[model samples]
Target chain A: MDIATQTETAPPPPPPATTEQQRASRGATRPGDRIFLGLSRGSGIVLLVIMAAIAAFLTYRAALALSDNTGNFLTTFEWDANAIPPKFGIAVLAFGTVVSSIIALVIAVPVAVGIALFISHYAPRKLAVPIAYVIDLLAAVPSIVYGLWGALVVAPNLTGFYSWLDTVLGWTGIFEYQGGAPRSLMTVGILLAIMILPIITNVSREVFLQAPKMHEEAALALGATRWEVIRMSVLPFGRSGIISASMLGLGRALGETIAVATVLSPTFLISASLLDPGGGTFAQNIASKFNEASEYGRDALIASGLVLFLITLLVNGAARMIIARRKEYSGANA
Target chain B: MSTTAPTAQAVTPDTLHAARLPRWTSPLVAIGSAAAAVGIGLAAGLHSRVQWGLIAAVLFVIASYVLATAVEGRRQAKDRFATSMIWVTFLLAVIPLASLIWETVERGSKVFSPYFLSHSMGVVADQDPGGGINHAIIGTLQQVALASLIAVPIGLLTAIYLVEYGRGKLAKAVTFFVDVMTGIPSIVAGLFVLSFWILILGFDFSGWAGAMALSILMMPVVVRSTEEMLKLVPNELREASLALGVPKWRTILKVVLPTAIGGITTGVMLAVARIAGETAPVLLLVWVNPFINTNPFDGAQGSLPLYIYQQYAAGSEASYDRAWAAALALIGFIMILNLVARGIARWKAPKTGR
Candidate 1:
């Protein structure tokens, strides 16, 4: 009777005892635990510091370049940063970068969304897996290889198409091709469209695959056809995913260096016709000019690189924002 | 669009009302449209296959819609149009991918002899070109290996913190910046390293400098992928190990890591493949040397991508052949890595490998 009374009196002793034991065992200040935690935490901190360092170094160098620039940095198309009384600007680079990437976006997004739908919905089970795998491997092809092929094979083959466009759509001005080898902004855009295809397809395909089976079946049972089912069920569900995927591809097209460097027969002026071989991208400009550039010239390239950096950051940031905002976006559980 | 089946056959049963075009309808229409496209392409004197493909795509979509509308109804017409468009898009993508691989193999094969792999570019001129990638191969292997050595530990540790112990503002900042870092252009990474290592500190051109830039490009990929892999290790394992009186670190080291090792390794390999073909950064930091360079710390080194770019820029038949061959080598390396990574993932699970 005494022992039972004692046990009842010491009610819930194990809870407090366990808490104390856990505190003692998992020690707040044990050297090993503290050190391990600190080291791992320190690694994360180091990554942040490295990012900060990149921004700082680039900003400082860019500022130095701007200080030496004789012409308006944003307006002038001239790139004589190495010349005496140097005058240079990023106008041409920015223009080409935006124009080419926009072209890539226009060309790639719709096609990518279509291909994603085909892989996710239209393809037979066996065909879909193998096709997706092949596309993934294509995505792994290096930019330099693309550059070589673009310069040699694709460039020559594109001549017929360029001439055809010129003859058919000459009134548009943008399609007016001079009888030169097809090293133009249009060609770069097409190449980038091809290059970014796999990424957009992969992302959009994943999103489409995640569409709710219940929703699809519901649409079908409502007497909707296959395309109607996709329109009513899958399209709305994967909209944000497709947008972000397109944006990621845009980022890649903007920053692409070697391929553009190899394919474009660059001139300093921004050509009104994309079929003409003129204008320069930020990355391509930096790379093509780096070897012969003086210190100030490199700094100028760094300034343009800074602009490209900021642009990509904004694009990727917007993508992340859309992805985050669409927390209720995916319809897999609906 | 009218419900033609229901209205036209009011006396018929609902079974007739819910009819769709037969499965064979699509295949037959596709073949018919393709034949028409070929006839039209030949008649119009269109030499490019791309034009023929476009015509076929257009014809197929039109035929699908027309046939489906005639047999089924308007809703089925729209459905067939979408399916046809999607299939056309798939074919469009396949054109470039198939051509790129075929052209590379067809052109690159002629030059990819064992002698080409083992020889150096020292004695051969760009115009006179009989040379190999022996030097570039060594440099690429060393630089990429060194980068992995430095990046794996730091990236792995950072991922562990994020998955296991991350809680407050600092962790949030790290996550945001890591995302930002992943999108940082390769050129910017090269520029940053150039300023920090060679310009500010007066270091000379070397493979180590290139490695530094490559590591920056590589680190975020490693962290993101490893974080995913580590997160996949269930908390039950951690709790179970801790309940047995194992230290937190030991529990993570023994149990969590072993579970996630395959995925982490795959991530690392993917990162390797990404950085291996990087040319812009290598162009800036490591000046290419034609001779065999065993030492990456002290002098210029040849790299495969740089070799491709340099050779292509030379604009000679011999140089182009060499460039194609090097490109083939680079593509081969990357594809093999990706395939192996896929194999490892499949080894763990038949699905969800990505």
Candidate 2:
């Protein structure tokens, strides 16, 4: 309670004000303080500048591409940037990026939470430690390796599964699969789900471990079952943490390049069926197309990249906000 | 004994012990479910083993819950059901991850060799039997090292600012934007550098361009990790140092940094590992060249991840083998970095309880 209120009313921490307060209270300032302060503050300023520069430069280049476009930048489907009147749009890329990320999130979040809960609550101490460690290592595995694995092993192995889905859910149109290699958004999404599971699990595991012990004990004292104790105490406490973790995973999925590029067969058109082969995400589009693009074509890809940047930015910002707000309510400054 | 017996009798025997499933029931149910699922799969002509597993999993939950509910009651059954689901989820995640590791090792070992490590794909065609990642390894080392050089100090200083002197709007904004920067897609970072350093500055594709993009990704990771490490330093240590008339900067440099150096190194190493695997930025900026180019500032270079991508894109049996081999090497490098970083973290964890 005291911690919560202290943070609530805390004054902003300006250095000079802090120094003056300190001197008035007990200590004296020293000589090299000014230069050191400038250097450190300069570093912080540089970081902000980098952020601003990224946004500014991307915007400038995106505008250059958008101005020469013969089609609506947001709606048109074609990507013929090198033509006399350049015509391109991000509609398909936007649809593919969002859909694939949503698919990843849907498949990943619940399983990630379960794993997190398993590590934090269910597993024995000896097993939990190693499992957690393994998850961390998995999280550190490179995206390209995942891409290679997805392309070579997962895609081929998934053909039967895709056919099953087509038979089971073909009426929905979303699961309709034409006879081909199973290089589709569904495959990309599933691969992304695997790629990001470790990250979400690791983060939510930390949060679940941090859930206050007293509440769980209290629930147990009320004759709650193990699952009941978790539902009453742990899940509520970790909900925000889980949300933020999922958001982080979502950010990654949206921006993932090589994995999608490796797995998904690239086409400009937006496909209604995730199991069918023709869709393109922003990052994958840029990676696959950038090599063959002209200078103007490159700028057009940059414009799509800017959209991806904005999306991930918004996702990460929301996650940070959730974490920050949780601090105020929980009195636990993460 | 007689008095205790009477008291125990006063409490109804049925109330004393609620019905419960036998201890061995879960495994029995799991086996039953698996047999049932396999039988059903065979009869239905289902080809995918994954479908069988899914069917088995669903049967296990249903059979366990039904058996439990019939005997122990609904509440206990619900608990058992949740336990089974959690286990299923964990196994589901683990299977693919283990498969990835297994596949990489099994397939990768077919072509992996010291010779494969030492040679380059410069002259070898995609279908050829002879080639290696020597040039890519060189390019990866140079790019990552250069990225580290650029990122570490700035990230370190920014972290110090946020931890030590930060208090007002500037600090808050920096903190917020640092979080935002953390999520910038690598390809966007590549695009940023493409626009600023290459496109606007008129520089050709080089390892330097890739490094610039990589450092952008690396910086935020470094700052976030270092900030956490710096925050872990006890305030009393700082107070004691300041009370002795040591300057603020000196105290920070001499005391706090020494205390946190292990963690900082681990953070930086982890950041390096992350960027080393990054293919998008390098794919955009470096423009993979199969031959070795030791000079980062000069021209196109090959990186381990980009090499894997290029080989995999080539679409041949030989190229696939090479790709897998390079992937194994890349994973090996990253795993080593991660292991070392975690080792340092464990080793340098504050020695308390003395």
The deviation in Å at residue A209 for candidate 2 is: 2.8
Off by over 4 Å in 1: A1-23, A328-334, B1-19, B349-354
* Consecutive 10-residue window with the lowest summed lDDT within model 1 chain B: B345-354
Task: Going through the candidates in order, state the TM-score of chain A alone for each one.
Answer: 0.91, 0.90
Cα-based lDDT for every prediction: 0.86, 0.90
Candidate 1's residue-wise lDDT over A25-93, tens digit each? Answer: 443346777887999999999999888898899898899989978999999989999997889988999
Scored by DockQ, the top model is: 2
lDDT tens digits, residue span B1-354, model 1: 377866777766668456667778767877888899999999999877777878887888887778778877887788777776787788788888788889899899879999999998988898876899999999899889888887888899999999888879988888877877887889989999988888878899999999999998899999999999988887777778877767777878998888888898899999999999999999999988999989999899999999999999989999989999999999999999999998887676312224
Question: What TM-score against the true fold does each predicted structure earn?
Answer: 0.93, 0.93
Instruction: State the lDDT at A246 in candidate 2.
Output: 97
TM-score of chain A of 1: 0.91
Clashing pairs in 1: none
